[model samples]
Target: MKYSKIFQYAYIVFAVLFIYDAISKYMSNGDIYYPSILLAALAIFIFFFRKRFSKKFDNRDNSK
Candidate 1:
C-alpha cells in the first residue's frame, strides 16, 4: 500500500506544529490543556488517515 509523499510530509508538518503548539501552551499555563490534547489527537488522526485521505484526493484528481 503505497502512499503519497505529500501526505507523509503533511503528517510531519502537522506533528511538528502540534508539538510546538503543545509545548508553548503547556509552558504558558504550566499544565496541559485541551489545545495540547487536541493537537496531539490531530497529529495521530492525520497519521492514521494519511493513506485514506491521500487515496481519496488522488482518485479525485485523476487527469484521465
Candidate 2:
C-alpha cells in the first residue's frame, strides 16, 4: 500500500513532465505535440481512476 501510494503520486509527476515537454516543443516550433498531450491526459486520468479504485477496495475490505 505504501508503494502503491507512492506510484500514484508518480503518475502526477509524470503528467507534469509530459505537459512541460509538450509546452516546450510547442514554443520551439509552434506546432501542437499531440502525443505528449495525450500521454499527460492519460496519466492524470489514471491517477484519479486508481485512487477511486483503491478507495473502493479498502471499503470492501473493511466491510468484510
lDDT of 2 by residue, 31-51 (tens): 999999999999999999999
Task: State which candidate has the highest lDDT.
Answer: 2
Give candidate 2 misplaced runs (Cα > 4 Å).
Answer: none
* Per-residue lDDT of model 1, residues 1-64, tens digit only: 3436666667767777877887897898887767756876777777768767776878888955
RMSD to the hidden true structure, all candidates: 5.3, 0.6
Residue 13 accuracy (lDDT) in model 1: 77
- Candidate 2, residue 41: Cα displacement in angstroms equals 0.3
What TM-score does structure 2 among the candidates reach? 0.95
Clashes of each: 0, 0
